[model samples]
Target: MEIRWLEAFVVVAEELHFGRAAQRLHVAQSPLSQTIRRLEASIGADLFERNTRSVSLTPAGRALLPKAYRVIQDLALATDAARTASGAVHGTVRIGFSGAFNHLTLPVLARSIRRELPEIDLQLVSRVRTGDGVAKLRNGTLDLAFVGLPLVADDIDSRLIARTRLGAVVPIDHPLADAPSLVARQLADDDFLSMPVDGSSAMTEALLRCCIAAGFRPRITQEVTDPYIMLTLVAAGLGVTIAAEDLASIMPRGARWIPLDDAPLFMLHGIGWMADEQSSALRAVLRLSEAILPTPPD
Candidate 1:
């Protein structure tokens, strides 16, 4: 019936003792009991089982506890946003990005968010996979995500912000390194260095499709997930791998990245946020991102 009632019910459910729950709520035990009784009556269900030796939630109470906790948490976040001093917007905006190519957007985003939204704190996570970003975004832990394309979740708005072309990473001394570019079939005979076949990075799919179009499945020799590590393996001559072209800037050592010349393969990149996001802090970050990283033409 009231926030206080839900609070009392939740505490009592947790403590499973009238005296303890009352003490935690800073109220007399009788009032706390009455509050739970009133809530149970309003819902027409027995919320708790009590006896001389023990107390515990009934099925209804157990079911309501998590929903009640979420209601309280959502209210607290809304209150904090509404009551922030001087109204400059104070809160942490968590952003998730997968793959080394994210190096392209994250630095500029961090600087922009700090300069533009001084009261907001930036929490950046190197989410190594798209599934990681999806899970965090849906759970409300991440406010924004730099996700690779082909995301199909209904609740996420995967707004295309940039595009990275698929390219091959090979030892600089490898024969293919001297060419401006080569067809996918040229590397068909060579062992491929790639992210694990797990569906984490979009490049994994793009590279596979490119090779398939070239009439062969890539002979994967290494299945490292991190882009930097895959490139390192490439440099060591373990095998050639597929990755975004921009990621070449991240590794200063032995790899020469060359794009597929005959059939260009590209990975579309985007920023993802919960489709219903209304947080001011999140909106500000999105605005800043749009200004700095507008999706390239077409």
Candidate 2:
């Protein structure tokens, strides 16, 4: 069957309304209906159960959904591969970066890529949480991603590019800010701003694990999805927070960053991608990452 037929079918399945699906596909309803009918005839089964008021996927359509998605996704990847083989390097490369990476490293990376690989277009997507970065990367949406160390997935391959220490970010005038260095036990009783319990923020979990290793489960006063917002709250004196050293570069006003005493220094940072296939843009970015960021001493 034609790819367009499957595309039209999937759109109808998702929208469940011919007019709505047609509009979403930027086509008229009559042609969309014709396409669906043609697809059904080819498959020898009706795909949608429709009436005057509603549209629903039939059994055949339900079964075809996953395969259709896979076929479309594979076809897109193939197209990108073709573009790469042609030496065009002209398609969009969606990159996922954390807030800290965006603030400190992206400018340099973007400038270098534009200068050297002017033919390859770049799209920057900032994920407030690292899990979002991983998810986007796995789903083929992101060509490459900047993530911290301790990415435990076996399906991902990464190279460590830089290292940053963990620190406590507090209000400038907060009592703990003046200490020589912050320790997990010293701030055990302090209300903290932490990441969601769902484990979306790797750095936050690293900090929490640090606290647990010191014999306490932090009394988190608030949980935020975005680490940047968590730091903002810390700056406002709402609560204390643990963040990477690079985070200080994007500190909101009134914040103080104190190095963690004997902290379990996080893996500084890494460029990651699916282990099975590496795209040209991803490899180029990885090489550039190696050049720009220092490799930690062995």
Candidate 3:
């Protein structure tokens, strides 16, 4: 079968709607339907169960998906390899980054890459959450990601790039705003807010344990991914939250940051890439990142 056929099939599988998949592929619905029908005929089985209101993948389609994904990823990697063999570092390395990485880590890394490896192209994606970054890296959509560390996964590799302590963000008018620093337990009674604490990183579990030690379990009032949004929610008198110290510069208009006194309760920021990544551009960035990101303090 043609690669386009495979591409069309994958898109349809992902979307589960012919019109939506066609829109994603930048084609009309009729031809996309025709292609899937032709693909099904060639493979001698129905890939999708379709009706007026819904579409679902058949067992055959489900079984073929991961293998097809691998075929596409391998083909792309081979193409990138061929480009690298042409004697110059060319091709884009898609790097997924989140809040603080976009505001802080990215600038330093970008300047270094531009100055030292101008031939390499960088596609920087911002606003990615930790879980989404992990998924993207695994699916070959992102070459690498700047993510929270303490990730133990069989499909990905991570290494520490920077370290930061978690701190409190409260509205400036709040009673505790003037406090210089705080022990983790002190915030237990406060209505807290934070990113999803789903074991995607060590911070979530650590935060819970810290609060429990502080004599009360935290009542999480909100779950947010954006630093500014967390601060914004605080500024609006919604709740108090915790965030990395590196993001202090962009604290929302009415919020104040108080350093946390817990020494070992810090976020370990790191680079996560697919275990089998072989991109020349990704390698160059990883090398530069080692020098750009500071060594963890003893």
Candidate 4:
């Protein structure tokens, strides 16, 4: 069967209105109706039950609906893959990173990807907010990113490549600085610096939930969007901030990194990509992510 006929049938099956489907398909109503009739004849099945009032799919049409949709989706994916294979992958793949990434790990991953996927160029971008990865992915801008959970974007697919212990970063001279391990409750009366509460920022949500799970709302004294600035605040003794243990390696001096004992031990960090589009660069980076990720703590 001609792909156009299947396309026309799928459109009408989804819309259930000849006129509206025709408009959506940017074709005349009469031609669309004719296409559907021709398609039904070719398949030897009446795909739609249409009366003067409305239209509905027959059993055969309903069964064909899902399969037809898959055909189109798979075709699109194959076409894209062909394009990628033809050296069309020579475009910059924009990547976003959450502020919570280990300072060393992020750069190391980027360098490895550049070495492996030379045809695909990469640009490192920073995002202050989170969970907007799906929107960027859908629009064809962001190829992949490293972000913290819980990411609420169902449209984008993520793999939990690594889990790092959560820790408190505080000034070295702070009262709790000497403590080898930190508990969420120990910081109850301490001034805290956190990310915003808006759902757009995934790391913010993670931090808020961490505080709540500890039994008391944090005495949040300042809200900043920049991770570097938040770390600076901790260094300046303005407030303490929580971070992943892997980040401790690159942290500036004069700050103490204390592991959280009773609190959720680890934060999930994942490599995310557009679920619908496959990228050669992304596949390479994802492989590197899996290789570099430190094993989860016991």
lDDT of 4 at 276: 64
Global CA lDDT of candidate 1, please?
A: 0.80
Q: Count the backbone clashes (under 3 Å) in each candidate.
A: 0, 1, 1, 0
What's the TM-score of each model vs. the native? Answer: 0.74, 0.78, 0.87, 0.66
Off by over 4 Å in 2: 4-69
Task: Give the CA lDDT, 0 to 100, for residue 295 in model 1.
Answer: 75
Compare candidates 2 and 4 on TM-score and give the better one: 2
For each candidate in the order shown, give its overall lDDT on alpha carbons: 0.80, 0.78, 0.79, 0.74
Candidate 4: list runs displaced more than 4 Å. 1-89, 99-102, 287-298
Clashing pairs in 2: 163-268
* The best candidate in terms of TM-score: 3
Q: In candidate 3, what are the lDDT values of residues 162-182, reduced to their tens digit?
A: 787778788888788999988
How should the candidates be ordered by TM-score, best one leading? Answer: 3, 2, 1, 4
lDDT of 1 at 201: 68
**Cα lDDT of model 4 overall?**
0.74
Model 3, position 133, has a per-residue lDDT of 83
* Better structure of 3 and 4 per lDDT: 3
